[model samples]
Every structure is written in structure tokens, then in C-alpha cells.
Target: MSENARVTKAAGVVGAATFLSRIFGFVRDVVIAWFFGAGLSSDAFFVAFRIPNLLRRLFAEGSLSIAFIPVFTEYLTHHGKEEAFHLARSAMRLLSIILVITAVLGVLLAPLIILMIAPGFTDSPEKYSLTVLLTRIMFPYIFFICLVALCMGILNVLGHFAAPALAPVCLNIAIIFSAFFISPYMADPVTGLAIGVLIGGALQLTLQLPFLIRKGFYFWEKAVIFHPGVKKIGILMLPAIFGASVYQLNILVGTLLASLLPEGSVSYLYYADRLVQFPLGIFAIATATAVLPSLSRQAAAKDFDALGNTFAHAMKLVFFITVPSMAGLI
Candidate 1:
């Protein structure tokens, strides 16, 4: 198929899968509201979840995928599949070690982190303690989800979009299952949601593994610790990480201010943000995800004309969908 057609087809697949995930996510939110309402537990859960969720976006899905894909695609286009796979394996090994250490530190520093993000929680000792506990419980999710993100980058480079796009549906399903099945039995019902986050992250990583293995990308293979591609990815990732961090810091500031508001203010903001994210995730992110591999290949091939056309096509598609959605929201 042609490049434009390929991009469109991939975007459609991703958008459809994201639509399903968002629907499930909406249901999950409704279940949470029904079970916990928008008070202390809900507020605490949102704050705790936000910390790791922010890190996930910053380090894993956003920066890591953005950096890894171009480099991985270049390796595939120029070097060969074997070289690309080696780079992926090397990245997987190194990332796993870093994520393990980060998770451990996040768990240990949950109190300090929570204090920095939501100082007003200190006013309510119970809320503060619960948020810290939940944060600790969910910190390990970062490890699983980041691995999933790496798998996603590799798969996308290999021309597989459906599995990666559908992975998030697993998360919403896990959370919904926890709300109905697990929370009732827990001493603190909100703790179940935290458990759900971990389960969802693991499930996402698990969902990607069979696909990766089928494509000959095995995690168990010996990896090069200091691969040159890994260094290049690291270099590309640093700036992206910084940009995401700045955006997240803005979010953290908002969360901090929200924590100081009325009891349900945090939950209110969280719900509104989710609503806004629905359209953005479905079209905007899907389009970008679909085009990345194509753009990377064109650049690798030094096909500047093709690259310009592909970039323009993606921009037009994004504007077509997002403009109307934004107007409707307004």
C-alpha cells in the first residue's frame, strides 16, 4: 500500500482501539464515582494515581516511545532487522533496571512526594496517610507500564498497531473489575483501585509480549549494555523528557492548588480532564502514533518530498478531527 494509505489505515485501527478503551475508561470512572463518590477517598486516589501516571507519560509512553521509534525505525531501514532488534533488547534490559530502582525509590519516598504534590493533604491526616499508602502501592505500576511502552514502540516500528492500541483497554477492564470484585473485600476500598493500577499495568505488558515474541523480539535474550543506538535514544530522549516534565509540573501545580480547594475539587478536575482527553486520545494521539514510523522511514531514506507530504497529511488529519471536537467542547 501507499504511504498515505498506510498511515490512514493504521490511524483508523488505533483510533478504533482507543475509542474502545476510552469507553471502558468512562465506565470505570462511573464505577469509581458510584463506589467511592467524590470525597476523601476519591480525591486521595486521584492524587496518588497522578504521581505515577505523570511519570508514565513523561518517561515511558511520551518521551521513550518518541525517542525510540525514530531510532529503531532508522536501524530497520538502514542497518537491518537484526540490528534493530539488538537495540530494542539492549534498551529493554537497561530500562528494566532503571525502572526497578525508580519504583523502589518512589515507594520509599511516597510520603515526601505526596507532601510536595499535595501539601494541603496534611490538613487531613487521614487523607494524607491514605494518599501516601496508595502512592506506595501504585508506584510499581511505573515499571510494568514503561516496559509496555517500549514494547509498543518496537511493535509500531514493525508495522503492528492494533495490539499496542488495544493494550489500554486492559487497564480500564482491570480497574472496573477491581471496583466491583476486589474493593468490597478490602479494608480500605480505595486500596483496591491502587491494586487495579498495578494489575492493569502488568496486563498491558503481558498483552504486548506474545506479539513481540511473534515478531522475533524476545526479552530473554542477552542484551548489549552499551549499545550505540541506546545512547542515541538516550540523547534524543533527554529533551523530550524535559519537555514532558515541564508540562507535568504544570499539572502538579494544578493538583496542588486543587488539593487546597473544597473536598471534591480534585476529583472534579480529574473527571473534567478525562473528558477532554477522550477526543485527544482517540484522534490526535492516534494520528501521531500512526505517522511516526512512516516519517522515520522517509527520513532514513532521505526522501524529503515524501516526508513533507506525510507530515502535511498528518497535520491536516489532526486539524480536521480536533478542530470540530474543540469547538464542540467550547
Candidate 2:
């Protein structure tokens, strides 16, 4: 298949998967709203979810995947699969250590984080405590989701899109199930949502594993502590984190401000943001995800012309789809 056709087809797969995920996500939101309403519980849950979700966007999906893909693709193109797989293992090891530390710290610092992000919650001691508890429960989600992001980068480089694209659907379904089946039994019903986040994250990671192993990317091997490709990914990730997460930072700021508003303000903004993310995820993100491996390979081969063409094609496709979606939303 031609490069353009390959990218277009991959995008279609990812977009379709993302569309399904978004639909389930909407249903998840509805279930939460039906049970919790836009009150203290809902607001607390949203704020709790937002902290880890922001980190997932900023570090996992935004930085790690973006930085890991090109480097991993380059390893595959020039150095061969064995060496590339070595780098993948090394990256996973380092990421696991870092994520473990981060999750631990996040749990310990949940109160301080909640204070910084939603100071107004302090006005209601109950809300503040609940948010802190929920935040701690969901903080570990960052660990699982980031690993899933690394798996996504590897799989996408290996020409697999469906599993990673379908990952979010697992999260949505998990949350919906928890809302219905688990929340009723919980002492604090909203606590179930936090547990769902962790379960969803684990399911996302689990879904990628069999596909990865089938492609000969197993996790059982000992990892190099200082692989060169891992170093390069780290270097690339610093800039990528800031570059890709400016919008997320804006949302974080919005979340902080929303905390100062009425009781339901945070939940209101969360729902609205979900509506906007639906189209963006299905089109813009899918196109970028599909194009990355191709662009990376072309660049690795020093095929500048092909790289430029692929980039241009992706940009045009994103605009063609997203502009109309944007207009409709407006």
C-alpha cells in the first residue's frame, strides 16, 4: 500500500475505535451524573480524576508516546528488531521505576495537591477530604496508563493500531460498570469511580500486552539501566511534554478556577470538555497517531521528501476533518 493509503487506513481504524470510546465515555458521564448529580460528590470525583488525567495527558500520551515512537521506529529501521526490543525493555524498566515513585509521592501528597488545584474545596472540609482520598486512590492510574502509552508507541511503530485505539473503551466501560455495580456497595459511592479509574487503567495496559507479546515484544527480559535510546527518549520528552501539554495546562488552570465557583461548576466544565474532546480525539489525535510511525521511518531513512509529504498529508487531513467539526461545535 502507498504511504498515504496506509496512514489513511490506520487513521480510520483509530478514529472508529476512538468514536466508540467517546460514546461510552459519554455514557459513563451520564451514569455518574445520574447517580451523583453535579454536587459535592461529582465535583470531588472530577477534580480527583483531573489530576491524574492531566498527568496522563502531559507525561504519558503527550510526552512519552511522542518521544518514544520516533526513537523506537528509528531503532527498528536501522538497528533491527532485536536491538529495538532491547530498547523497549530498558525504557519500560526505567519508566516503571519512575512511575512507581511518582505514584507513591502523588498518593502521599494528595492533600497538598488538592489544596493547590482546588483550594476552594477547603471551604467544605468534607469535600476536601473526599477529594483527597479519591485523588490518592486514582493517583496510581498514572503508572498503568503511562505503561500503556509506551506499549502504544511500540505497537504503532510495529503497524498495530486497533488495540491501542481500543484501550480507552476499556476505561469507559470499566467506569460505567463500576458506577452501576460497584458504587452502590461502597461506603462513599463516589469512591467507586476512583477504583474504576485504576481498574480501567489496568485493563488498558492488559489489553496491549497480548498484542505486544504476539509481536515478539515480551516484558520478561532483564532491562538495561542505561540504554542510549532510553536516554534519547528522555531528552526528547522534556520538550515534548511542554509542547504537547500547553492545552492541558490551560485546562488545569481552568480546573483551579472552576473550583472557586459554585458547587457544580467543576462537573459542568468536565462534561463540556468531554464534548469538545470527542471530535478532537477522533480526528486530530488519530491522524497524528497514524502518521507518526511513517514520518519517523522516513526521517530515520533520511528520506526528507517523503517525510515532508507525509507530514503535509496528515496536516491537511486533520484540518479537513476538524475544521468542520469545530464549526459545528461553534
lDDT of 1: 0.94
Measured with C-alpha atoms, the lDDT of residue 173 in candidate 1 is: 94
Provide the TM-score for each candidate, comma-separated.
0.99, 0.99
Model 1 worst lDDT run, 10 consecutive residues: 217-226
Query: Model 2: per-residue lDDT, tens digit, 50-134?
Result: 9989999999988999899999988998999999999999999999999999999999999999999999899999999999999
Against the true structure, candidate 1 reaches a TM-score of: 0.99
Per-candidate count of clashing residue pairs (backbone under 3 Å): 0, 0
Each prediction's RMSD to truth? 0.8, 0.8
Model 1: how far residue 288 lies from native, Å: 0.4
Cα lDDT, model 1, residue 133: 97
In model 1, the runs with Cα more than 4 Å from the true position are none
RMSD of 2: 0.8
Q: Per-residue CA lDDT of candidate 1, range 1-330, in tens?
A: 989999999999999999999999999999999998899999999999998899899999769999999999999988998889999999999999999999999999999999999999999999999999999999999999999999999999899999999999999999999998899999999999999998999999999999999999877787787899999999999999988898788889999999999898899999999999999999999999999999999999999999999999999999999999999999
